[model samples]
Target: MEVTQANILETLPQDMIVEILSRVGQNSSDQLLILKSVCKSFLKLSEDPLVLKRLSLDRWRLSPWGNPKLIYLFNLCTVFGNPNAIFCLGLIGYFDTKYTDLGLDFLKRASNSQLKEAVYVYGVIIFASHQIEAKHVGLQILNETFPPVPELVVAVRIKVFDLMRQLWLFNRHPFDDVAMPCPISDHDGYFPQFHGFEIAIPECMSCFWAYELDVFANRFAYN
Candidate 1:
C-alpha cells in the first residue's frame, strides 16, 4: 500500500490525530475548518468534543465574543467539561445584560476549577456589578494563599497593579443612580450595578491579564 497523506493519517492513532487537529485549530481556524473537507477521519477528528473545546478557546481568546458558530462550539465545550470555554462563554455574556445571570453561573463553575483567570475576571465583574456576593468572593481571592510559585507571584502582583490602574482610569466608581438588578434567587437581594458602556480599558486589561494566566495554564499542562 502506498504511504499517501490519507494513508498516513489513517495509520496514526486517534489520540495522535486529535492532538494534531487540535494544534491546527489553535494556530489557524481557517485551516482547521478546511480540514473538515479532507477526509472522513479528519472530519471526525475535527468534531471531537476535545478538539471543539480547544477551538473555542482559540477562537475567542483574543476577543470577548465571536460569530454565532463559535458560540455554538463554546456551548458544546461547556457540555464537555471545558472550564476555559465556560469562562469564555460567561465573559461573552457580559455583552448583553440579559445574559449576565447565566454568565455569572458559568464563571462560577470555571473559577471552581481553580482557573485563576476565571476567578479574577469573575470577581471583577461581580464587584463591578455590585452584587453582594462579591464581598465574600473578593475576600477569598484576595486572601487565598497559593504555594510560592514565582510565576503566580508575578501574575498576582501584576494583577493588583492593573486593578488599581483600572479603578483610577475608569468610572467604575460608585454612582448615585441604582443599576437594574437581576435577582439570582429568592433569598438574594439586589444592589446598584454598573451600567454597560463601551468595552473599556478595564475589560481590555482584564482580558490581557487572563490571556497571561492562560499561557501559564498551558505551560503547566502541556509544556
Candidate 2:
C-alpha cells in the first residue's frame, strides 16, 4: 500500500482543516500585517487617521459579550490569506455598526483580488457616510465622496441624502452628523410630506435615476 501526501491531506476532515485555518488566522504574524498594510501605495492612514479609525469602533460587534477569545477567529481570513469570506459578509450588509470602514480596510488589504461587488457596495456605504460628513465639513468634499448613489441603490441613497441635508441644515457640522442620530423612517414609503422644508424634492428622483443609469451604463456599477 503506497500512501501519498495528497491522500493524507484529502483524508483530513473538513472541520479539522477549518480549525487549523482558524488558528493560523488568530496567530497571524506582525510581518504579515505589515506586508498587507503596505500593499497599496497610499492605503495606510496617518497616525491621527488611525485614531479616527478606532474612534467609533464597536468592539462588541467584533466579539460580543466577554469572550474576546474569538476576536482573531473573526479575523481568520486575514491569517489564512483569503479575504473573500469577510468581503462576502460585508456585501450582505451585516456589518451595520462598523461594517463600512471595516470592509474598506479589508479591501485596501486585498486590492489585488477581483472585488467588483465589494467595491460597489463600498461605494454605497462611502456615499452614505460621506453624505453625512458633507453636512458639516462642507458639501463640496462630501459631494466628491458620496456623489451620485449607484442606480440600484438610488432610492435609498436619496433618502440618505435628504436626511443628510437636514442634518447639515440643523446640526451644522461634519462631526455633528455622526454625533446626532436621525430617527429616519422611509419618507417615500408612505404618504409623501408635501409640506415643510423637508419635503421630498424632484431632484432626489434625479439622484435615483442617476444611479439606475450608472448601473446600466457600466456593465458593472455596484451590484
User: How close is every model to the real structure, measured as TM-score?
Assistant: 0.50, 0.27
Candidate 2 residue pairs in backbone clash:
136-173, 136-174, 150-211, 151-211, 151-212
Look at candidate 2 and tell me the lDDT of residue 115. Answer: 41
- The residue-level lDDT of candidate 1 at 95 comes to 31
**Candidate 1 local lDDT, 1-223, one digit each (tens):** 6667877778889998899887787676678889877788998888787676566353344233456776666567678777777766555553333566786788788777766667766654443434556544543553253342334645754553333332221222222232322223332222223347322232222223333333332322321
Whole-model alpha-carbon lDDT for candidate 1:
0.54
Number of the top TM-score candidate: 1
For every candidate, C-alpha RMSD to the true structure in Å: 13.2, 15.9
Please report, as a residue range, the 10-residue window in candidate 2 with the lowest summed lDDT.
51-60
Model 1 compared with the native: what TM-score? 0.50
